[model samples]
Target chain A: MMQEIRQQTDANAVHRDLTRLPLDTPAQQAEFDAALQANLPREAAVRRQYGMDRRTFLKLMGASLAVAGFGASCTARPPEEKIIPYVQVPEVMVPGRPLFFASTMVLGGVATGVVIETHQGRPTRLDGNAEHPASLGGSSPYLQGAILELYNPERSTTVRRNGAPASWDDFRAELAGLSSANNANIRILTETVTSPTLAAQLVALVEMFPNARLVQYDPVGRDNVRAGGSWLLIRKSTPITVLTKPKSSFPWMRISSLVCRVACATRGTLWPATPCAKMQTRPA
Target chain B: MNQLFRPAANTIARLSLLASLLAGVVILALLLVNDQSPYTRASVGIAIEQPVRFSHKLHSDQLNIECLYCHATAEQSSYGGIPDTHTCMSCHSQIATYSTLLEPVRTSYATGERLVWEKVHDLAEHVYFNHSIHVQAGFACETCHGRVDQMVVAWQAQNMTMDWCLECHWEPEEYIRPVEEVYTFGYEAPEDQVELGMQLVAFHEIDVDRLDSCSICHR
Candidate 1:
């Protein structure tokens, strides 16, 4: 049996060498001949030794056939599954048909509008919402990955204090105690605020604590580019740039427009050029 | 050689050999029978009980209510959606308001809890059966369901095995009818069924060659 296996491996090596050989040149033909000569003698020697008698071979084959026959009968019937119907079906919902809802996903301070496709109340897919000013029927990998994040099992579900699980009531009581201490130093750390409701809340929180400080920080913020004099304007957290600098000789070839186009291409929030109207525009 | 076995022992050995052969044959036959039996398939004539004893015979056969009235999405959706509690109360609120038979339905509507009806005809998970495509192809409800209007307690009428589905799919021209007769129960094919089915197959634009493809049903 060992001799037969060795002979089989030798034959396989020869077959592999033959397939790998490019017979287009005389050198390759010579190499192929060398490989064949090296393996042929060992194969012949191994073949001369007998592996198993016919009777033993027949017995093993018969045993395998019986085992296979028994294995075939072992498959059980499929388990039962239930189909639970809704108590009150939504007006617009039809079973097996998907409904798309317009929503927004925020990442690193930028919000992109997306259309989420839901099947029977479970969101199954996501795409860019065309009607929204921020999306304009375009999407990014980060926007698509939001679905994975939404369904991620490792996502934080409850309040935690210093890596240990805590409750909201306990946190609220601690916060009340700290505020009532009169001279407590409170520092609020948050991402860049864009939503009007959140911005108003943060302002009210500071007003109530008098000495409390609010710090807005974004890891991927374009502060470096702004400091480097890149003509990028920030107005109410929306990145807007002057498309046509009137005083410049070449208004069309302005670097600011090019930078703005590249920066805001995925954002799809290019404001209409009205010479910086209303709100004060700052570099950072 | 030493007379260790009696003369009658030869007859016993031969009789035992024959009995063993008979037993093997009997076991094989039983296995074959069990494979095709309703106990294994769990289908055909097994009426599963539901929370409410809703009778198809009364609603469909006696009252002559159309099948589409309850399963409205059957023509447009893959699923023949089960009627919600609101659909039941649509009629029961005025008709069977005080009946004890509809107490579960009333309680479900009042509390906004779903009625846990037992599923009768459950298909294999891999088989992606669509009702709308079959309905649009002009296959009558009775073609596969087999006189559901006659069923007092709903039961699976056909085995619905892969071979049973392939029988219609293999030769769609032999089964299809006019679109108007899709919801008509107890519909009988005409004498010129093959000829009419051929026309309907073309009218419905069903690709016969693609019907038998693995992805068509499996996917």
Candidate 2:
């Protein structure tokens, strides 16, 4: 290998004219002849004196064959990748790129706006939506980890009743049967629901059954504070403490101000009696 | 008689061994050369088989549809974004409704299953490339993607190596085009290309030093 490399380097230096050399002297010619002789077929006498035995030769052949076989087997042929195009491609997607959709994920009864990065149509990543009010370009750990949950293989894929597999249709049919039966003992048990649609549905179900009752229970919930807030409204008029911090991370724009308004409406009086409250009430 | 045959057999054995060694070396060299060649890469200059035989040449070159019409997020997001099935159905539904070639497309639409497209010019996972930043920098899509509008199958024309990216990053004035012509497929250089590009670079306030930083692409 070394000799071959040296010859190749010399050949390249000589502009690839391999037919003749500029050997000017007999001594130089002799040196060239010796170098050429070194590459010629060796005599049997030299082989008998110093060459490896048949055992060594066989061992070498076995090693070389094993190495070559292993190398050949190790090289993974890249799979024949296919590009499956959309039969009816959506207006928002392109062929070779990822698309982001602005959506919301419910965490602890509050909806946090998130932007999901979809490769083809499968959600692969999640980030907070910069434009959304709940999440201003920042996501909680739960929202960030939602993509993993979306792709989790262990996630339940079917509805079940009594630990037996049942489809969504079966569940719906059961719900229909219960509603039609209209039993006087019918009761609805649920966790605190901030969603207006779900709350309305529960209210309508109770109204449908004259003797039916609806109960809200949560192990870790904010409903207690909300219930206390309602009681406070009915009882003695509590002093509205307007806590305004000058250094605010969130912008006091339409979104944050609306949040403040909801806080005031639920827990305390909306009217600002203090001077600081009046000063901080400017719509920014 | 036995001694005479033994020498002859030994000579033949030695010759065969030498021949096998030489053959192995030659085969190994050929394999190495073949592996390094562009033809073996399978990504460049070869037509990638897609589910639906979509043609960019027909849409962009013949029909004159803008690149951004389908890749709507190119200028706004990090990704250029592949169009959804509904986008193709908007046109293909009427034209190729009964064609057997569009069977996959129709099947996907009916079943609501997304077609998984194999990316032709995928970068290393560690490298982060933002298409919006490049578009905002006034670099034409063809500058990196090559003449995709002219291709029927859209094979990767360039190697897309880090070295190749660095070549333009070192001298971005030569690559920068006007923002209006960013989507142009095969833009020709004007007589004063260098001067115009330099002026545009200045006008756009593109920080050349910032572009050359490792964090710019690697992050």
TM-scores, each model vs. reference: 0.67, 0.56
DockQ of each: 0.23, 0.17
User: Please, what are the lDDT tens digits per residue for candidate 1 over residues B1-219?
Assistant: 124356998999999999979978976886777666776676678887888889999999999998988888899899988988888899888997999989999999999988888878888888998899899878888888889999899988888888889999999988898999887887878999999888889888889999999999998
Candidate 1 structure quality by residue, lDDT tens digits, A1-284 = 99999999978877775546554468865665565456665543443355433344688899999768755653444456566777789999998888899888875555777899999998877777777655556666666777888788787788888777799998988888888877677788987667899989889878778788998787776555444444444332333443434446553442333345443532323222222222234444
Docking class of 1: incorrect
| Interface Cα root-mean-square deviation for all models | 12.2, 11.1
Scored by lDDT, model 1 comes in at 0.75
CA lDDT, every prediction?
Answer: 0.75, 0.69
For A106-213, candidate 2 gives per-residue lDDT tens digits of 654556678899976989888878886555556555666788999897777888777788999998888787777777567677765768999999888788787788
- Residue A173 miss distance in model 2 (angstroms): 3.8
